[model samples]
Target chain A: MAHSTTLEPTATPATYTDAPRTGTWDGGNEPFKASYGKLMMWFFLLSDAFTFGAFLTAYGMIRHKHGVFTGTAKQFYFSTAHWPIPEKVFNAFPGLHGDLPLAFVALMTMILIFSSVTMVLAVEAGHRMDKADVQKWLLWTILFGSMFLSSQAWEWSHFIGGHEEGTRMADGTLMFGANLAMNQYGPPLFGDLFFFITGFHGTHVFSGVCLLVWCFIATTNGTFEKRGHYEMVEKIGLYWHFVDLVWVFVFTFFYLV
Target chain B: MSAHAAEAEHAYVPGEIAKPNTAWIWKTFWVLVAITALEFVIAFTLTSPDWRTFRNSIFIVLTILKAFFIVGEFMHLKHEVKSLIWTVLVPTSLLIWLVVALVTEGSFIGEVLSHMFT
Candidate 1:
C-alpha cells in the first residue's frame, strides 16, 4: 500500500480492505526516532527525579525549623544543644580519626564522578564499534561503582556503630549512635534523611553497575555486533550519568550546605 | 523502480566508525576534578560563620555546574534534538519550582509554631 506524506487520515470507501499508511501517530515511527526503551527510560528518570526532590525539600523544611548544631568542641562538651554540626557528625575516617571532616565523602564523590567518565568512554568506544575497548571501559566502570558502594557501606557502619562516645544529656542518658528513632548527631530527622537520600542514591549506583555488567556480557558475546548498533551502551550511559547528576545535588544540599 | 527498492539495492555501508578520540572525555574529567577540589578548599578554609550564606551559595552554584557537564557531555543530552531535550528538561523544572514553594511554606509554618510555643 502507498503511504501518504502528511499525517492526516484520509476518507476511504467501506469496501476497501487495505488502507494506505497515513504517517500518523498511530504508526510506530517516532518523530524523534527514539527507541521505545530509551524514551521510557527518560520518563522513568523524570519521575524518579521528582521523588528525590520531594525528599530533599522535606529535609530542607525540617532543617530550617530545628536549626543545626553550631557548637564547637568547647561548647559541644559543655553545652546542652541537641543539634549537631554536619561536619562534626561525619568526621570519622576508616582507619584514621583525627577530625578529617568531609574527606571521606569527598573521596567517594570523586570515585563516582570518575566512574561516570569511564561510562562515557564506554559509549564512545561503542560508537566506534570497538568491542574490546567497550568491554574494558565497562569493566572499569563496574569496578569504580563497586568501590563507591563499599565506601558507602563502610561509612554507614561507622556512623551506626559510633566511634567515640557522644555527649550525655542531663537526664542521665547517653546520646550515641544513629537510628530512625534517635540519633547522636543533631536531630533524629537528620539521620533519617541522610540514610534515606544517600541510600536511595547508592541503590541507583548498584543498579547502574548491574546494567553495565549486562552490557559488557552482551558486547563480548557479539549481540550488539550482530544487530549492528551500539545504542544500548548509550542508553545505559545516560542512566549512569543521571545517577552522577543526582549525586551532585545531594552532595550540595546534604553535605556542603 | 520504487524508492524502497532503490534504497535496498544500495551497498550496506556502515556509518563512519573511525577511531574515537578520547581527548574530550579527559578534558571533562579534569574540569569536574578541579571544581570538586575547589569545593573542598572552600569548605575547609572558610570556617567563619559570617561567610556561611556566601559559602552555601558557592556550593549550590558549583553543584549545578557539575550537573551541567555530567548531563550535557557525559550523557550527550546536549547533542540531542531540541524537542527531545525539552521533553526531559522542562517537566523536571516544574519540580524545582515545587521545591521552592514547599520550602517557603515550611519555613512560614516554623515561624507560626515558634510564635505559639514561645
Candidate 2:
C-alpha cells in the first residue's frame, strides 16, 4: 500500500536509502531512525533474515547428502534400497481419506500465502492512517494465521501419530523409517532431516501466529490508533512477509524442486 | 549497459516518489497468481525428463518473479533509497550463492562416495 507519491524526506535517518524525500523530520532525534518505526522494521527484517538463511542452508546440506531418495511407480528407490516418495508419505486427506494427493498441505500453503497478502494490506492501510482498513485486513491476517497454525498442528499429529512400519526388534522397539539395516527410503536420515526442517518451519509459523494474534488484539484495543501511527503494521508486516518468503523457499526445496 | 545505467541513474533524482501505475501492479498480481497456478499444474502433470527440466526452470523463474513482486511492491523495496536496495538484495544474493555452493559441495561428496562405494 505504499503510495506512489513524490518521495518526501521527513526526518528519516540519513542512511535511509532511495532518493532523499522532500519532507524533513523536525522532531530532533538520532538521524538513523527518522521514524523509530521504520528502523525497527529494518532491525526485525535483519534478524529474521538470518533465521531463514540458516534454515535454508541446513536444508540444502541435508538434501544434498541424500542421493535421489525418491522412486516413481514403486520401482526400487535407487541402486541401494529406495525410500518412499515424499508425495506418497505426505499424501493425506481429511474426510475423503481413501485416496488423495496432499490436499491438506496444499490448503495450508494457500492459507499462509493469503495471510501474507492480508498482512501487507494491513500495513498499507496503516500508511494511509485508515484504522478501519487496518482492522479489517489485520483481522483477516489473524484468521488466516491461526488457520495455518491449526493446519500445521493437524499435519504434525498425522505425521507423529502414525505407526512405524517395521516389526519389533530384539529389544521390542519397532525399527521404522530408514536406518543402516533397513533401507526403506534410501536412508534413515531422510525422516530425521525431514521432520527437523519442516518441524523448525512449523514452529516459526506457530510463533508468527502468536505474534499476529498479539498484533490483532492490540489493533482491536486501539493501540496503534493511540500511538497515532501504524508502524506496528509495518513491523508486523516484515515478520509476516519473512514467514512467507521462507515458505516459498521451503516449497521449492521441500516439495517441488 | 551505459545507456540503461545512465537512464536509471538519471531517473533516480531525489524528492518525488516515483508513482508506478496501480493498474499495472494489479496486472502483475494477476500474472503472478496465474504463473503460480501454472507452476503447481506443471509440477503435478509433467514427469518427462525434458519436461521436468523445463518445469524446474519455469518454477524457479516464477518463484523469483513472485519474490520480486513482494519485494518491489509489498515490501516497497522499489520505493526505498538505493542504499536500502543494496542492503536488502546484496544479503539475499550472498545467501543464495552460499546455498548453491554448499549444496554443490554436498552433492559432490555424494558423487565421490557414490563412485567409490558402488
Candidate 3:
C-alpha cells in the first residue's frame, strides 16, 4: 500500500448545536436530571394515570345517571333516589360473620401502605449500598404485595359470589351478586365499574410484584452491585409507590365515597 | 478494578445508611392510617342524606392528602428537583380537571335527559 504524505479530509463538516451527545429527543442532559429510564417511567405513569382517570370519570358519569333512581322507567323522575352505600356493600370481612363496613379494605389499605414503607426502606438501603438490607426489605415488600393481591382475589371472589340475599325489584325479579350485565348493587354500572377499576388496579399490583421479584433476584445475584448503583431499586420503587398511590384513590372513590 | 477507581466509580460509602432515620416514613404511615380511619368513621356515622355531598368532598380531600404523602415522600418526588416535580405534578393536576369536567358535564346531561324524557 502506498502512503500519501499530504492528508486531505473530504467529508463535509458535521453540524453541531448545544444539544447533548445523545439526541435531545432521547432526553439527554434534560433539566429533570432523571435518567432516560426514570423519565420514561414517569411518562408511562402519566399515561396510565389518564387511563385510570378516564375509567373513573366514565364510571362517575354513568353512576350519576342510574344511581339516584329507584322506581321503574315509567315514573323514574318521580321516584325516591339514593346511591348504593359503598360501606354497606363492602361491609363483610374475613373471619367475621357480622357486618364490618370497610374493615377488610381498611386492612388491605394498611397492608399496601406498609408495603410502600418497605419499598422506601429498600430504596434507602439501595442508596446506602446495603445489599442485605435491600434483600430483606424487598422480601418484606414482596410479601406485602402478595398479601394485597391475595386479599383482592378473595374480595373479588366474595363480591362475585354475592353474599347479600337477592333483593326484590318492582317486577319481583331477584338480583344476585355482581356481573357485568347485572348486579344486586344499586345500579348495573356500579358492579361493572367496580370490577373494571379494581381489576385494573389489581393487575398493576400483580405486575409491580413481578417487577419487585425481578429486582429481588437481580439483587441476590449481585447485578446491582456490579453496576455500582441501585437505581433499579429506585425505579421499581417509583412503580410500586405509584401502585399504592392509585389504590389510595380507588379506596376513596369506591370504598369511602 | 483498583480500590480507588472502584470507590470513585461507585461514589457511595458502603455500610453508611442513606436517610438513616426512618421516622419520616413511619410518620407518613400513621398519617395515612389516621386518614383511612377517619374515612371509615365518617362513612359509618354520617348517615344523613344531607351530608352525602359534603362527605364525598371530604373523602376526596383526604384522599388527595394521602396521595400527596405517598408520592411526595415514599416516591421521593418531593425531594426531586423543582422542574421534575412540576413536570409530574402539573400534568397530574390536569387529570383532576378532566375528572371534574367529565363528571359535571355528564351529570348535567343526564339530569337534562332524564327530566326531558320524564
- List, in order, the clash count of every candidate structure: 1, 20, 0
Among all candidates shown, the one with the greatest DockQ = 3
lDDT of 1 by residue, A151-175 (tens): 9999899888764777565577887
In the range A1-257, model 3's lDDT, one tens digit per residue, is 89898988777556543444676676454687678898888888888988888888887777676546333323322111345767667878877898787889989999999999999888877877889999999999999999999999989988887765766555568766778877676666677888999999999999999999999999999999889889999899999999999999888888876
Runs in model 2 deviating more than 4 A are A1-34, A69-84, A162-186, B1-29, B49-51, B115-118
The docking category that best describes candidate 1 is acceptable
Error of 2 at B13 (Å): 30
Q: Residues A144-234, candidate 2: write the lDDT tens digits.
A: 9888877777776665554235434445555543433443333555556667667777777777778777887888788977776667777
Q: Residue-wise lDDT of candidate 1 within B1-118, one digit each (tens)?
A: 1322122123334654556667778988999999999998998887676787799889988988898888777876666668889998899889778877877887787678768867
Q: What is the lDDT, from 0 to 100, of the residue A72 in candidate 3? A: 31
DockQ of each: 0.41, 0.23, 0.42
Candidate 3 lDDT for residue A184: 70
Model 3 clashing-pair count: 0
Error of 2 at A2 (Å): 56
The best-first sequence of candidates by DockQ reads 3, 1, 2
Q: Please list the C-alpha lDDT of all candidates, in the order they appear.
A: 0.80, 0.65, 0.81
Residue A89 of model 2: what lDDT? 58
Candidate 3 clashing pairs, residues 3+ apart or interchain: none
